[model samples]
Target: MTINKYPIIIISLILLSLNLQAAENYKKFDLPLDLINYMEISLEGKTAVMTVFAGDSSQSFRMESLEDNRSYHEISYQGSVVLNNEGFMSSGAGYPFDLIDKTDVVFDNKKTRILFYQKDPESDVKFRSRKKNNISIFNDINIAGGDFIRGSVVSFWADIVINGEVNEDVIAVYGDISVGQQAVIRGDVISIDGKVDIAKGATVYGRVQASGGKKKFQFDRWTRWHNKEKDFSTIIRFYYDRVDGATPLLGVQFTDEDSLLPNVEIYSGYAFSSEEWRYYVGLEQSFWLKHPITLGGSFYRKLATQDDWLMQRNDNTVFALLATEDYRDYYEAEGGYIFGRFTPLSYFNVEIGTLVEKYTWLDAHTDLWSMFGGSKAFGSNFGSVPAAERASGIEALDGAEMASIILKSDLDNSDREARFGQSFWMGTAELEWLPDGWNDDFDFTRYFVRAGRFQSLNEYSGFYIKAGYGGSDGLLPLHRRYFLGGLETLLGYRHKEYSGQEFWLGNVEYRLTFPKTDITGLLLYNAGQISEEAGKLGDAEVKQSIGIGVSFEESLRLDLSRRLDRSDSSFQIYVRLGINF
Candidate 1:
């Protein structure tokens, strides 16, 4: 054998190449038996090779003609037939039925091996019987039971069954996933250019993110002064509440410039109250007809409930229902406007529109028809009676008289334009009394004018001082105006605490802002008066406070104030989440 090793090696190389060429032209075969029964089979040209195996030791088969291509050999087996390192066998091309009842067998082509058995064998079963061999090379190969072309990539497309749990992330970027009914995914899922279809009983433990290249633009300049993208993005937030249960806050917007159309959005939250269940819905839309003109409108509604009515009295009285366990209430409000804007000058713009509003309230055992006085009716007195006499004089005015008074005064002049219209309708003309450069020379100046029985004056332009005489009915409460605190007036005190109907109401503020940071400082002074008549000086109330705070990214603000009126005054804290204007 040593003297002729070269001849034997040359013959083996020729036979190996012939077998590979034969496999290239192999034809597939379909047998009547179940495809899962036989261990493995493959075809090569006119020859079909198969390996049969069984789990029972009593069952066995043999390959009697198995031999190397250079030798004529025969073997008989009562248990198993073990192929030598170099062995070959050939048979007619077709499904092999002769080896179906074999006990155990293996057919290998170096790259992959098919082990036949009646039950699933462990992955390392074949290697356990062999010794000192690297098994990783065989793992790169797969056993194919059906006809598969040699040298072609094999892709498994059937449904994957994972009996246990997968503890790590699973990502699919461009493929479709059809989850089985019993499947469960316990991690986050991110899909791009693909879709995941979860069956009826499937569950996903983490969030699912799905996105596409869809263009969206939102113009929410009014609410989001600092973050322009927030107006255009869609967001969903899940939150758990104490009483009303868990809920999701959603925001969405869309816009189309070619069509000159845009849409507004809203969200759901319990920030408005902590006691009762609450919800809000809002929407707005706008469009441009011409280049210079635009039209828009919006609608919003809020609903809540509370138990007791909280009252605050100043020049007017406000009643708010506070939430309690036994009481429930709801409110709905909706309004819209159609507006047109015109820019007559480069630096100046004007906008005008008509607004319509409707509000409704519902509750258990509540007076929905109760009358509420407005700003215009707060100062109106029916006659010249002292405060004590006027309080008891309600019996003198009948229903018709009260109705006449309300219709003539309150309903007609609550709005600034309406008041001016009423004055013009009564054959009266308003005069403009602007003191030339009132604040240029002195901090204080005076201006006065008369319209019928009404007279008005201003000291230092900032302080509106008024006195009137003429009508026998005495002073109409509408003319007696004063301020407590507001955005434009007292920045130091709460707007609810300020009240007056006559005399002096003035505010002075020194404001400074740091150029390097968002901090703003303010020192303010506020004063006001209330009276039964226009000429009489009412009670004098003065309020002053100092505060400093910072605006967060120009979107939110927090301010703290110390009241100057009292020694033990608690610091008033305010949080504004959005723009004040």
Candidate 2:
């Protein structure tokens, strides 16, 4: 074998010269790994033509193999061609010589690089003999900011980034995809190991799925309609609260649909609320036994100051006794019970529950009570009831007496040294009508009526007519049983001035918006009162206040109001975030 070294060298030199001339006549380009079996590469002028065989077994040329096997032939115009792992087919600037069978090809101006890989022509696998497979696997297709027109079927298991918008019908399978806020995906997105981030203002029209061990999926700042159905089997939130001159609080919440069982939920929290410190611990569970049917129970306990009670007192009392002594007392309330709900239709749901609650004051005094309530929604025919009407309602004599008597009886039986006296029960119901075409043009009108058996006071019934156009910025909660000046309903009036169970409240507001920022300006009028008790309806004094305000940062609001009832009208300012309710 070593005897012909001189002759072999001479033949190689001649073959290399001829090969160099042939290379100069034909151009070359890169080919992807997936298309290696059926791709033919050649060159003509400045254009590179890549013929990909789609019949069956495709043939591909590996640049490294060509260099090694054709050592005798010289490559006059030499360049590297890349063959991707999946072999979808790609090329550099090589002109195509010919195409065989029914195969389609497209040239991308944005992607200027092509790849080439090694292949054996004498192998038993023929180019047109292999069966066609629907799923085309790509080693890696990296689209930085260009368009990738997937022909029939192409799948990838890598990263794909679209700096701009991607048109429709582009299916990409990957471990992860990080889409910028400016990026738009017009087709389906599927991921197995990675998560997706649809940034604020981004849009995705197809379904998105993130399976396997990945977590922490977030959807932020989206503007158009979005539907997200995710299985959050593992998620938790920890919350802590501390305030000056008050108690410190801490709690954790677990939100998993199956944490407990099918249709069953368990929630627990603890906190302390006192003049010096306040705290509470609570737990709740909810279960869905059937469609439109649910059952739930909860237990809670809190240790807080007597001052906290003042916050829950009636607005009329708070305003009247503005200079009351601070009740630095400690109390705890804990209880649990079962409840059931029924929804016969989409617009309406009714719930019934039995709950037993025990309250202990100063760790020595205790009382117990029970509760029951039902809610329903009528069709749109009712002029939508504003938040004010829903919040404020006449306290019916029977309902008020029932609540007061229950608490008083519990305290008497608890062997606690406390005020033992007769109380009242008042039950009131209101019907709000918002006609289909109701608007601010006509003075918004509401009629209220209440009737009940007052234990201490006489059995009574009262009716009132409230009319106003706009007072959405008023301090008072319009829907409350009675309108009283405070941080909510009447901005400029003192909290104690308004007292009693029955009173009329009204507010009218006119809003203006800026053309550039779209911020809103508000002018409002608010007024209302409370009576001495459930029955006696006389000496009804009315207080009117006007306020001017603006809303910015969407919900942050600021308003200034002046009482119009007096000559030296008093004014008050309020700064708040979010809606009143």
Candidate 3:
């Protein structure tokens, strides 16, 4: 259902034209915040009244918090406005929509119409942050633009702009904040129920939080914070798997989180997967060289084997593999590498990294099932050329020195979820050298390509498709080979069920977001083929699955699927966070 938007737009324009009186001049009423619990509201001549319990001891403030020198909540009504079951809340129109339970507002005080939020229209979800503080904003405070001017702590109602250094927190309860690109904030910059545009390059020593979300022209701080730093910090993470046993990792990362600096990560990990321990140290520094270039390098001994790698999406999503721990893929590798990234344009990036390491293949399955597929001769992932042709068995080092190049282009214009309306492409070609001579049987050149696109069928619906291909010109060490058969590539199949030098996978999905309720429905299809070693791809057995899923607020998701390739396979289900990235 559509509402008349013109009237609301007019009301918004009128509100913007008026300089709102200080909340004090507007007849404030310290109304009880809990009255809404009973769906109750009472109004009188410019006054609203109700009962409420306050303080840790459930007593009135009476300035006790001030005397005790602590912050406290002062929630109340600014006008004698009456509230009904259809409560009212608004934002960006000289109104600070205090959030309690995200209740809806369904009316206009005047004959004006107001536009209510719809899930599809404002589908884009950027990084929004919240903090726990009892601070209250009351007056107007402005930090005038200047050259390196040191700022002080402030709270205000009128909008604010910071073009200089702020030594303290800046709070805007009823307005927005414009932080200049060069602005340096030593403390938080908070917009209480308002918007904030933090220009690119701005540095915030503390968090930038907003209660009613945020608007942006710069970096999606939340995305960078979580994706870059969080992922780096996960170097210390722990993993559990029946086959790998207990995997515990410990690490420390410096993402320049507290200042403008390069990122550094160091970590160590060990688990039963190979009963091997590894260590790593990495550093990345990004700067503008005509365009933007990130020069980074790392030295590490990490699990380069398929069995030890859980193969999670960069978005940190896990599917059917989370439920089934029967891992039948295994390998081992440890090395150090360095790389550089050059982003010549907004939508494109190219990178190169080189590593020298030792590769070893292991049995993912301790029993008989572990020894099948791939070469057909051994019925194991370590096949023909590498195993049969090698003087030593699979236990050998399989030494290799490799340089890799990766190119990626992304122009996904859709909201946070896997995205739609644009396409993203990434491909790689890597040449590995057998420094130990041609007899080492571990030299090969690998080529990989992956592309995806999201088509917006309408405001509330979209179609998404992903395609992947991987192949190696000579024998790639078992650890360096391609593997499919899980949520990331082929759904409903056993984790890493197929290990081969050449593999391809395809995925298609339709997503629909329900209006008003903020729920999304999804239908998914997956198919893939695996060639033991550059054999006939057209004849390779096809693996496929069909599934359906639902997502709430783009965070939680659940999928149920069935394998079409396996007749004896039962329904497979999964619960994971976010969409495929």
Task: Please tell me which predicted candidate would have the highest TM-score against the true structure.
Answer: 3
Q: What lDDT tens digits, residue by residue, belong to model 2 across residues 1-581?
A: 01223553465456445444543453222232223334544422223333454346444443423233222222212444332333333344332212111122222332212222222233212322222222233333444455433221223354555455554323333345665565556544444335655554444544444433434233321222332222224223232212111223444344322223323233333332223333333334433211234445555544423232123323212221232212122234455555444433222333444434344333211111112112211111001223343223221111121100000000011101110111112222222222223222121222243222212111111111123211111122112224356555566875434543456555555555454563667777777655544444446666778888887743566889999878798678765444322
Q: On residues 1-581, what C-alpha lDDT tens digit does candidate 3 reach at each position?
A: 12233553465345323312221132211222222221112222223232222222211112211112222323323322222212232221112222221111111231111111112212222111111111224434445566442223333345677777765466564467788766777656666456777776677655565544233223344543443332234454665433344567788886665323688888887766557786778888865322445677877765444322234422221221233223333445565667656554434455555565555444533221122222222124333234453334354444543433332333332333234322233333333333334344454666666677765555577777878777766666545677776656766876566767788888888988887666889999999998876756777988889999888877777888889976888877766565545
TM-score of each: 0.28, 0.36, 0.53
lDDT of 1 by residue, 1-581 (tens): 01233443465456445444543543221121211343443322223334543333222223322222112222223322322112212231222222222211122332122222221222112212212111111012222223221111111111222222322222332233354444344433333234545454443433344222331122232322221122266757543212222334576665432223355555655422222333344333432211223345454433322111111111011111111111112233344445443322222233433433333332222211113312211111222234554443333221111000000010111112112111111111111111223222111111111121111111111111122212212222211123234332344555424433343344443334454554444444444443444445534444565565555544555666666777977766654443321
Candidate 3 has its poorest 10 consecutive residues by lDDT at: 110-119
TM-score attained by model 3: 0.53
Q: Assess each prediction's global lDDT (C-alpha) against the native.
A: 0.30, 0.36, 0.50
The clash numbers for all candidates, in the given order, read: 5, 100, 2
Residue range with the least summed lDDT across 10 consecutive positions in model 2: 402-411
Pitting candidate 1 against candidate 3, the one with the higher TM-score is 3
Better candidate number, 1 or 2, judged by lDDT: 2
Q: On lDDT, who's better, 1 or 3?
A: 3
Where in model 2 is the C-alpha error above 4 Å? 1-245, 257-291, 303-332, 342-349, 360-483, 537-539
